[model samples]
Structure formats: structure tokens, C-alpha cells
Target chain A: MTRFRLGIEYDGGPFVGWQRQENGPSIQQCLEEAVAATVQEETHVYGAGRTDAGVHAIGQVAHVDILKEIAPARLMAALNFHLKPNPIAVTDCAVAADDFHARFSATGRAYLYRIANRRAPPVLERGHVWWVPAELDAAAMHEAAQRLVGRHDFSTFRAALCQAQSPVKSLDRLDVNRVGEEIQVIAEARSFLHHQVRNMVGTLRLAGEGKWSADDVTAALAARDRAAGGPTAPPDGLYLTRVVY
Target chain B: MTRFRLGIEYDGGPFVGWQRQENGPSIQQCLEEAVAATVQEETHVYGAGRTDAGVHAIGQVAHVDILKEIAPARLMAALNFHLKPNPIAVTDCAVAADDFHARFSATGRAYLYRIANRRAPPVLERGHVWWVPAELDAAAMHEAAQRLVGRHDFSTFRAALCQAQSPVKSLDRLDVNRVGEEIQVIAEARSFLHHQVRNMVGTLRLAGEGKWSADDVTAALAARDRAAGGPTAPPDGLYLTRVVY
Candidate 1:
């Protein structure tokens, strides 16, 4: 058996998140089916992260094992051929050691959140961005984001349905910047509590709009209560950018 | 009646084109109907450029006359409210002289052609860009593009059904550059023959792919015949970036 690591890009608008669900098609199922069709074997592909619905990805990583002896390039082509009509694509593929588990072997993950700060609604990026008509002070948001960085018990930012046992995680970086009409927030971490990034962005947004201050964000973290945090940002604006092993 | 000049932005995926075609909805129709609904009077909005189907716009200009005494900000808000559910927005509006025609008074126009130079088809930018799998030398294409940047008869690049009386037009700029995995071509002119930008991109792509040389591009221009040029690029990658008056 040969194990292959695949780099993927997808438009998550039409998906029911990454994990398989009874509601609709998932990115995982699409990729697994495509691989099964390519190798003529019912193969199961494991992903590094199971992103939520309407969340995009640029460099999502996955792994699958198959018995076929095919070149990585040819396997990529055949998988893409069968994956067509779906918005998922295996952009890169490489041979991997049998022990290289996609999820367990990951060392870090990164995410990007896009906010369109303008009076007018989005025309081209309607479903891909969060539209905030009110002006956001990115500088304030950046300052507020700093208070959430480093190791902390992020219980206030954790989702209620999160499967993780502990809320303690080390946040490597959180950056907020304004580029033209969009305000972007990028977060990197070894691992994240469910909805952690979204919760942080939501609180920073409140700070940017003058509803909260840096002190408020710090207090929320210290409170360690979900009710003390801001609302969860929409999934449409979130993107799983990369997963580093 | 007060004449207003409006700056517009739209995603052309759902529209037939800029012009009002009987087969489907057009951007022009959408704007006119929205304005009429806001002012409670039938209004006609004229655009500086009429983009084809699946062609996007970032800074399209238009002129409209309204009998209602509404401020620019209010007019923008009211028109946008009426234009809801459509991927079109009036980004800016200003009062203009009665004689300021959107089409006739334009002194220059700019367009951007985007090609995703990658192995995999674009997922996030699927409708917004053209995906080309082959590797391209953008620097070589840039050098070749400079040869077509003067006043000349652009018959080789003009569409067969172009309505321009003369093929001779001043080509101000045809700059090409590569940013990461994307190749962008920005073209500007006082006015252009139909399919002029797309035609140039198509031919330049040939040079980028090593199918044609810089000398061949010069020879095609010297020939001044439509058959001497390469094929027209798809409309999906073309964007009406700006219109200068």
C-alpha cells in the first residue's frame, strides 16, 4: 500500500462542512469518492481539518492510502477528472510515509477572515466576505487582538459543541490589517478550540466599531466564560489557509 | 431634472451583458429599473462601456437624470435599496452637467485581464478568472505587449463584428505583470474596438506559452488583418476596470 498526501483548494459555499453529514455533500466525501473512482477502490481520505459549511480553503491537506501503482501527477489528473462538477480540486499530491497521518502529524494551522468595510454591499465577493457597512478602526482591532495572543485558557472563545477536551491552546499570531476596502484578520496556532478564531474576530470587530476596548477583550479571556465573549462571526468570511506538518 | 454621474460595480455572472438583450436581464436594465423605482419616474441610465456576458466591472461609470430632488448620498442609498438581491451596487454618485454623457464624454477606458496560471482550476475565483494550466512567461508577454502600445490600425485585434468606423485608435498602455500564481494584463486606450483587449491577451498568451515570438506579434500588427491575430480570450477573465471622462 502507498500513502499519498494531497493539497486541496475548495469553494465551501455548496458543501455541508468538511465532515460527512446526512444533510448534504461534504468536501471529504467528494474527495474520498473521487479517489475511489480514480483507483477503482473504496478508499477513505483523512483530512487535517474538518472546516464548517461556507468556509473556504486554499491549502487544505489530506491523506489517503491505495494499492495502485500510479505516478502522483497522473493520480492528480485522474482525481480532478472525476471530481469535476464539484468545486473541490486536489491541487498537489506527493508520496508520504505510512505513518504520516494528515490530522495527527500537523504541527500548525492558519486561517484568514475577510471583512468588507464599505457603505455599499459586496457585488463580486458577496458570499466570500463579511460585509460591515460601518467603518472599523483596524488599529484598535489590532491592539485588541494582541491581548488574546499567547497561551491562554480560551473558554470564552470556545464553542459549546466543541469536541476538544480542554480549552487551553497556544495562539502563535493574530494580525489585523486594512488593505484598500477590506479589513483582514489572520490567525495562526498549533491547534484551535472550536470557533476560537471566529470568536476572536467577532470580539475584535466589536472593538473596531467602538463597542468594546482592549480591556474588554482581556477581561473576556480572564472571565473564561462563553457568555462574556462576543458573537460568532459568520462562516462565509472564514478560510482555512494552510496546515503545516 | 438633475443629471447624476454614478460609479458602479457589479458581478456579471447572472446578467446577460451590459446591454439590454431580449433574451435575459442586463446590467443596464437592472440599473435603470432600480433608479426608476427610487425616483418614481422612468429613467434611463447610460454606461460608459458595455461589457459582454460574464464580464465583471469595478469602476464602471454611468449617467442618469432624475426629476426628484434627492441628495447624492440619499439617491445612492435609495437606488441601492431598490437594487437589492442583485449583485450590483452604485458605489458613488455625483451631480453632473446636463451635457455630460457617460459614453460620449469618456476620454479613456481601462480594462484588466486576469489569467490563473496554475495546474488546478480556480475554486474561489472560478467565475472571476480564467484558468490556464500551461506555464506562461509573463515577462516575455510584457515585452511583446509594448510593441502594440501606440496609435495604429489594430485590425488584427478588432472583432469581426466591431462597430467602430475605423480600426485606428490610440493604445495608451498594454502592461503585463505576474503576481504569485496569477498573470495580469492591464490595457488602456482612448477607445477600443470590440474584443480588442481580449484579442491582445489571446495573442500575448501565445507568446507567453512560446507558441509565438515577439517578432510574430509585430508582424501580426503590421499585417493589420483579423485573421493574422490569435483567438479571442474568454469574457470570464475580462473586467471593465475604469472609465475616465
Candidate 2:
């Protein structure tokens, strides 16, 4: 058996998330089908992150094992050809060690969230960004984001449906900055709870609006309750930027 | 008559160019309909540039006359409210002097062209950029682009359908740079012949691939024939970035 690691990019708008589901199409299903068509083998495609619906990815990583003796570049080309019309692309493909699991071997992950902070709605970037009509103080949001950077109980920012065994995780970075008219939030960690990035962004937006202080965010985190956090931001603005191994 | 100068932004993907046509929807038709709904009057919206289909704009300028007495901000908000779900936005509105005309009074116009220079297809920016898989030498393209700048008779780059009285126009700037995986080309001019920017870019792309030199570009310009230039780049990568009056 040959193990191949793949770098993937996709627009998650149409999928039912990264995992396979009966409700609708998924990134994994498409990828697996493409692999089957290329190698005539039914293999499971394992992704580093299961991104939610309407989210996007630029540097998502995955792995698949096939018995067929196909070259990596040839497999990538075949997969891309078979994944036609779908908004997924196999950017890079390489031979991987048998023990290198896509999920378990990932050392870090990074996510980017974009907010169009302007009175006029975004024309070109309609679905890829969360349009916030009210002006946001990006500096305030940046300051508030610093409070959630270190290791702590993130239950306040966790989703009720999250299946993570523990609420405590070390957040390597959570930075907020304004780029042109958009407020961008970048987060990095070893792993994250379901909806953690969206929840944190939603909370930071309140601080951007001057409705909450950094101390208020700390207080909310200290509450250790899902209801204590701000509303979850929509999945449209989130992007799985990178997965490191 | 109260003349209003409006700043417009649009994703030109859904329109049949800027002019109103019987074939399909147009940006002017949408903006005019929105204005009619807001002011209860049928008025003509004059634009600074008549962009082709699939061309986007961030700072497109237009002018309209309304009989109603309304504040500029209020008029802008009302127009925006009326132009819902169209991927169009009225970014700014202000009362203009009687002599001001969106098209005739414009002193300069700037356009931006984006090329996704990567092996992977763009997922998030699919419609907004041209995907060029080959590696492009941006420095070569930039050096070649300088040959097209300055006052020149641009008949080589002019479209066959161009109706301009003269082919001579002063090109103030043409700069090419690589931004991550994307190649950005910025062009500025007092006025341009139809498809001039795209045509210039198409020729410069040959330089990027090492197939043509800067001298070749100068020779193409000196030919003064539409057939001498390269193919016109698609409208998808072009944007009317700014209009100066």
C-alpha cells in the first residue's frame, strides 16, 4: 500500500462540512470518489480538519492510502481531472510514511476570519466575508483578543455540540487586525473545539463595537459556560488557512 | 435640477456590461431602477467608464439628477436599501456642481488586473481572478509593461470595436508586481481605448513567459494595427479601481 499526503483547497459553501453525511455532498466524499476513479480502489480520505459548511480553505491537508502503484504527480493530476466542476483542488501530492496520520500527526492549525466593516455591503466578496455594516474599532478588537491567547478553559467559547473531550486548550495566537476595510482575525493552535474560532470572533466583534471591554471578555471566559459567550459568528467568514505537521 | 455624484461598486459577473442593453441585466439598469424606487422618478445614470461584462469595480463613479430634496447620506442609504441582493452597492453619494459629469469631466481612471499564478485553481476568488497555471516572471512583465507607458498611439492594443476618435492617449502608469500567489497589474490613464488594459496585459503575459521581449512589445505598439497586439485578456481579471475628477 502507498500512502499519499495531499494539500487541498476548497470553497466549503456547497458541502455539508468536511465529513461524509447522508444529508448532502461533502469534501471527503468527492475526494474519495475521485481517488476511486483514479486508482480503481475505494479508499478513505482523511482530513486534518473537518471544516464547517460555508467555510473556505487554502492550505487544508489530507492523506489517503491506495494499493495501486501510481506516481504522486500523476495521481494529483488524475484526481484534479476527476474532481471537475467541483470547487476542490489537489494542490500538492507526495508519498507519506505509513504512520503519518492526517489528523493525529498535525502539529498546528491556523484559521482566518474576515469581517467587512463598512456601511456599504461587500460586492465582490459577498459570501466569503461577514458583512458588518456598523463601523468597528479594530484596535479595540485586537486588544480584546489578547485575553484569550494562552492555555485556558475555553468552554465559554465552545459550542454545545462540540465533541472534544476537554474544554482546556492552548491557543498559540489570536490576532485581530484591520486590512483595508476588512477586519481580519487570525487564530493558531494545536487543535480547537468546534466553533471556537467563530465564537471568539463573535465575542471580539462586541469589543470592536465598543459594547464590551477586554475585562468583559475575560469575565465571560471565566464563566466557563457556553451561554456566557457571545453569539457564534456565521461560517461564511471563516477559512482554514493552514495545517502544519 | 439636483445633480448627485455617486460612488458605485459592483460584481459585474451578472450584468451585460455597464450600458443598458435589451439582451440582459446591466449595472446601469440596476442602479437606475434602485434610484427610481428611492426617489420615485425615472432618471438616467451616467457612468465614468462603460465597463464590459464580467468586469468588476470598486470605485466606479456615476452621476444622476433627481427632483427630490434629500440629504446625500440619506439618498445613499435609500439607494442601497432599494438595491438589495444584487451584488451592487452605493458606496458614497454627494451633490455635485452643475458642470460635473461622470464621464466627460473625469481627469483620470485607474484599473487593476489580477492573475492567480499558481498550479492550483483559485477556490474563494474563482470568478474575480484569472487563473494562470504557468509560472510568470513578474519582473520581466513589469519591465515589458514600461514600454507601453507614456503618450502613444495605441492602435495595436485598441479593440476592433473601439469607437474612440483618436488612438493616442497618455498612459500615466503601468506597474506589475507579485503578491503571494497572485500577480497584480495596475494601469492608470487619462482615457483608454476599448480593451486597452486587457490587451496590454495579454501582450505582457507573453513577456512573463519569456516568449517575448520588451523590444517586441515596443514593436507591437509601433505596428499601430489591432492585429499586431496579443489577444485581449478576459474581463474577469479587470476592475475599474478608481476615477479622478
Report per-prediction Cα RMSD to one decimal.
Answer: 1.0, 1.0
Docking class of 2: medium
Candidate 1 interface RMSD (Å): 1.0
Give per-residue CA lDDT, model 2, range A1-245, as digits (tens): 99999999998989999999999999999999999899899999999999988788888999999998999989988998899889999999999999999999999999999999988888888888999999999999999999999999999999889999999999999999999899999999999999999999999999999999999999999999989888999998999999988
* Candidate 2, B1-245: lDDT as tens digits: 79999999999998999999999999999999998999899999999999999899999999999998989999999989989889889999999998899999999999999999988777678889988889999999999999999999999999989999999999999999999989999999999999999999999899999999999999999999989898899898999999999
Residue clash pairs of candidate 1: none
Q: Could you estimate the TM-score for every candidate?
A: 0.99, 0.98
The lDDT, on a scale of 0 to 1, for candidate 2 is: 0.94
User: Candidate 1's residue-wise lDDT over B17-62, tens digit each?
Assistant: 8999999999999999998788788888899998988889999999
